[model samples]
Target: MSQATKTIQEINERIRKGTAVILTAEEMVDVVRAKGKSAAAREVDVVTTGTFSPMCSSGMLFNFGQEPPLIKASKVWLGNVPCHAGLAAVDAYLGCTEPSEDDPLNKVHPGRFLYGGGHVIEDLLRGKAVRLKCQAYGTDCYPRRELDKSVTLADLKSAELLNPRNCYQSYNVAVNTGSRVIYTYMGPLKPGMRNANYATAGQLSPLFNDPFLRTIGMGTKIWLGGGTGWVIGAGTQHNPKPQRNERGIPLTASGTLMLKGDMKGMSAKWVRGVSILGYGCSLSVGVGIPIPILDEEMAWFTGVSDADITMPVRDYGHDYPNGVNNVLAQPTFEELKSGEIAVNGQKVRTVPLTSYALSLEIAQELKAKIEKGEFLLTEAQDRIPSK
Candidate 1:
């Protein structure tokens, strides 16, 4: 059946009989290249893609439904990381890098604590107690003004991961050549292209596999935080209008995904809190998506190689993080991952902010779940951009 005609039930049936073939995103490339897209489409039933990296645009919502003397939590701290406690009396939104009260850039660059929202989440999953401290404006109805206590994951009535952005379609390679150390979300880059850091799953990423979001849109099935999740929307900076190459793949930064899932069901393995030297806190997340084979075109897209995907390597020493990002080198993920690349005729060391090995594991794990009729794929409820 064509992509327009294929149904979830039909693909699941094929998987049940062991006649349908499943391939990791890395393996799909060879299968499609050798057998051709048409042959690969008919033979491969699903392709599992994965990415494991620090996601800055991720956060969580915590609701303490059963707390005494309900107070409007004005300011909240969890595991020494301050949370956005302005939501309600008992609710808080803790982003991975929500700066502490004393984190003044002018005073102390890349300040201390080094842990924030993400660490709290991880510790909670590990069954460690989180120190919950908050101050509330005294109110007539909910009179409690302040609270200092320790709570566990079980203490929360509802904990959900509501990430506004995650899984960037692709990102720039970062380096510093301005004679000063540059601290960035990617990682710290030493001066003179001493180190280069890049983040992405390359070929084994969901949005990369489906550049146009043909089969992956709103409500797409995803492996989030070790459990099932759904694509809530297109991410914050999703640039559908980004410049693309001959293959229609973005040449610069592009799309991202909004994910939603229950926090209680998540595992510490798939979700982690990271401290990027001088860059503050971040959540090291593992995400996997299974693409259902419906047409030759779909198979072709899934097989797009790392060489086909391109990104700019930028000098991060300058200000205006996304702006004024001059291209230092244009390298494919293949070249970046080779442990070194030429920069001004000097071979520079390359470091990965995310774990490629973990990404492969996530993809393989998701594939096994689907092949065994454990994981389910959901059709998009609406287009991500609604365009």
Candidate 2:
């Protein structure tokens, strides 16, 4: 079957099931007159009621205003309708086509009616757009000599780059012919991970021979880079006490620290100190850059804010209880060529209004202009007020 034929069949099936029907223009105005503005605003509930009904009848049903007169058709039977039928009636009234079986729209599941509907509308009104960053540490070490306080060539070749003691050497050498001896300390370590030796005051004398060669500090820095993921240290994991900023906003140390600038891609240095047989390692200090995401307004609406009215209506599955009659009751007009009413704001579409207040106002103005002979009506049949 042609696409349009299939759509029409679907709509007819909905009507046969007794779903709510959209009001004609005249019916819309009457509903508004019966229900005051305040009560009309609450019509969303009435719409909900029809959505859950079990009878298959299609017509504009008003909640606040005088209920529309019941229409009886000799050929049409009314009573006991299924939920699908009710939904179909709504679709027919709105002149909307159901997504095909294979379409993604058909796959979407329904959520809470109000919130889901609002969210859909909001998405339609605003354009959708999403942003993503990764980072690591680097460390290095080298060796020095104990004799003559200078780096030994042999020690340099075998020295563990990560070990401080292996990388550097201390020694005493006789200078000139005098009794004085010069003490020197030397070693520029390259970056890496390795083992190092530590010398105490007494141990230094045995390793260096000269009593002048004594103990010194034992520590080294190594460059560390890429890992499985970002790591947070204990200091950050368990902050002692929360600190407040100048604005009195409390800051927690136990949060992800972002790296800054080029540091995000660059390696960091890790410093380790030798003690006993094992080495104590600490993370290298570095800065990080925070990745930017959505703009403030969009973020607030999509993320933190709680407002419901801003959400869209289409996302809610376009299930209008009152159907196309409800749409026609308001501002919608049937296009002679397409047999569909052009919706306002959106590319020709339709929406359900709780009451016909706006439509009535427009009709009244048109009547007045017509009485004043502002323009001529081409078709006398069309000039008649729609019931």
Candidate 3:
């Protein structure tokens, strides 16, 4: 392939003129197969990728209005879920996995987690009433000590969905080879490798289409919970260097993203509360990213299919908890998506925590937005560090 490249400005101009060629990540694979990667690069302007899955590292930041007499809040709770009020007087941060203060976690039965912080966020987004309780010490300028009230999303001064880590590039396939059943964040795994669960959008994943994090970095625009958002920076535990196959796709967890957006502009459908059988509650978020076809190399990367991507299979029951770096097998996404994969000569059923159909719809929606000039690709202000 020659060193042909397309600039973001050029693509934006085409989009403004209603002539930009946009395709979903799934469609790019076929186009690259029919024509060559070089030809596809010159023909296509942008490729959209999407994922909708339970991201536990998500949370919300809220600024409740100051109360009468102006007391300094020391502790805050929403719908019985605790929130960190270590910031200013009315500023608090609610983590997704924070269980309710009165929740009978695992008391009734093993893995009987019911309510948590994720549910509270969902309730607020749906315009449902949530009870807010706060405690504050009397200050010189403040007099009130304790307060309790009901609030909704509209009542908050500002609400922002701030996720420290999200959009894992590739993840492990969780399975159980132990004697008894085990509950994990991946889901309930049956004994003797009866079931396997994986989380990722495979080829439709944003990072999978940009294995090297070439175009995705700080300040890149993205679709977050059906609203516009931006990548803040490299997420926590971001492992840029990981084991990869000959195709340059990571075989395990790799890149991650720090995403933030306005909560009022989001939809409850995409930002949902999820309760795991044994694990605590987490938020399932919809994320879509647009990749500009800058050159032939980017075209090749975006053309990757499920058949070309691979993931590591790990025993969640024992090895994961024990922190053992052992891989049972490496299976392609195509095999896992087939609803079954062979592990240690035994056939195991495969399941996904994410919705592939919904992710595809998000990609299609992003494509339409770009085609209508409602969305434009933004060059990264700073690229994420590989280290």
Candidate 2: C-alpha lDDT: 0.17
Provide the TM-score for each candidate, comma-separated: 0.93, 0.13, 0.97
- lDDT: worst 10-residue window of model 2: 47-56
- C-alpha local distance difference test of each model: 0.82, 0.17, 0.91
How many steric clashes does model 1 contain?
Answer: 1
Show model 1 residue runs off by greater than 4 Å: 1-5, 16-19, 99-113, 319-322
Error of 2 at 361 (Å): 2.1
Ranking by lDDT: 3, 1, 2
Per-residue lDDT over 252-343 for candidate 3, one digit per residue giving the tens place of the 0 to 100 score: 88889999999999989899888898777899999999999989999999999999999999998889999997999999999999999999
- Which wins on TM-score, candidate 1 or candidate 3? 3
Error of 2 at 234 (Å): 80
TM-score of 2: 0.13
Clashing residue pairs for model 1: 72-89
lDDT of 1: 0.82
Per-residue lDDT over 326-369 for candidate 1, one digit per residue giving the tens place of the 0 to 100 score: 77777888888889888778888989887889999999999898
Candidate 2 C-alpha lDDT tens digits along 1-387: 111111223322433453313222233334445654333322211100000000001111111111123211111111101112132111101001111122232235321011111121112112221000001121122111111112211211121111101101111110111132211111111111011111111111111111111111111011111101121111112222334323111222111111111112222121111111111111112111111111221111111111111111111112222231122111111121122232233222222211123223323333333234331222111111111
Q: After TM-score superposition, what is the CA distance of residue 168 in candidate 1 from its true location, in Å?
A: 0.9
